[model samples]
Target chain A: MALAKVYVNYKQSILNPEAEAVHKALKRLGYGDIEDVKLGKYFELTIADGKSKAEMDKEINQVCDKLLANYNMENYHYELVETEAAQ
Target chain B: MALAKVYVNYKQSILNPEAEAVHKALKRLGYGDIEDVKLGKYFELTIADGKSKAEMDKEINQVCDKLLANYNMENYHYELVETEAAQ
Candidate 1:
């Protein structure tokens, strides 16, 4: 079986409210050394089938492109992992 | 200034609802080599301080401990990076 990971994040320089809130809280807590913050989402999946690794990769990529990811303002990237077949 | 990253994931044995859904969808589309799925969250922050890297690390750790991370059913770890001081 293969594993896949999809990570989505706002592009750098884009102000992130989530990060900003955390930064503010940190400052209020007296650790005022932080300047900014950003957040990201991650998705992982295990692939099982009789297909080739390449086929799995293509399918995973499609999942990302179609539903698992949103590209309106966030950027999405993914990694495909191949593991030793189980005994 | 230092940069911080927090990565949180469900424990290995924990069943992930999000991942299960993705696995089923991939199966419906064919090319299903996936057996499971899991999800994670990521946080990044840019810290600016007159303090040393060690000090920043300490503060960031505190932030993690007090807030900024949810430890219930999730495990979190962080990395601290010191960037070249802006000239």
Candidate 2:
């Protein structure tokens, strides 16, 4: 099994000027569908076999804490998506 | 063919406080792997068939300009990695 990660955020966080510029351009493009446009990160990782879901989950948790997450300006939530084989 | 995106960041741009904290922790971890670690974003997308590379590149540029990239404090660089099948 493999693990993937996705992060969602507003491109401009009152922190990133680049995000703000994109936000302005998006507004001009008439994508008025959204009130605020946020940007996020996504990751897809392949895992080694022979480990249970629980073990994988533990490792993933550690990775998120140790490497994947910032836990300050960016807010993150995670989910597990099954590939066709698993289904 | 499909489109994939990867965004690299320093984690802490002297802008994101959370990324800064994580950077500090990493330094203390004793891995001593490097002087600094930056965080990045990665995306993998499945594209509809029948599009040429140039066509896809155009669309990707639009997406990055209109959405994915902030164009301000955060700088972004992109590359496309072919999948195993293509190789």
> Which candidate number has the best lDDT?
1
- Residue-wise lDDT of candidate 2 within B1-87, one digit each (tens)? 443454644323447555455456645754232233334454333344466777667655666665665656555556654444421
Query: Cα lDDT of all candidates, in order?
Result: 0.73, 0.50
Report the TM-score measured on chain A for model 2: 0.69
Model 2, A6-82: lDDT tens digits are: 45443234475554565566568753322333346644334445667776676556656666657565555656544
Off by over 4 Å in 1: A12-15, A48-57, A84-87, B12-16, B49-53, B85-87
DockQ, prediction 2: 0.10
Residue A36 displacement (Å), model 1: 1.1
The candidate that wins on TM-score is 1
**Mind giving the per-residue lDDT tens digits that candidate 1 earns over A11-77?**
6656678867777887888875567667888777766656787777777777777767766667878
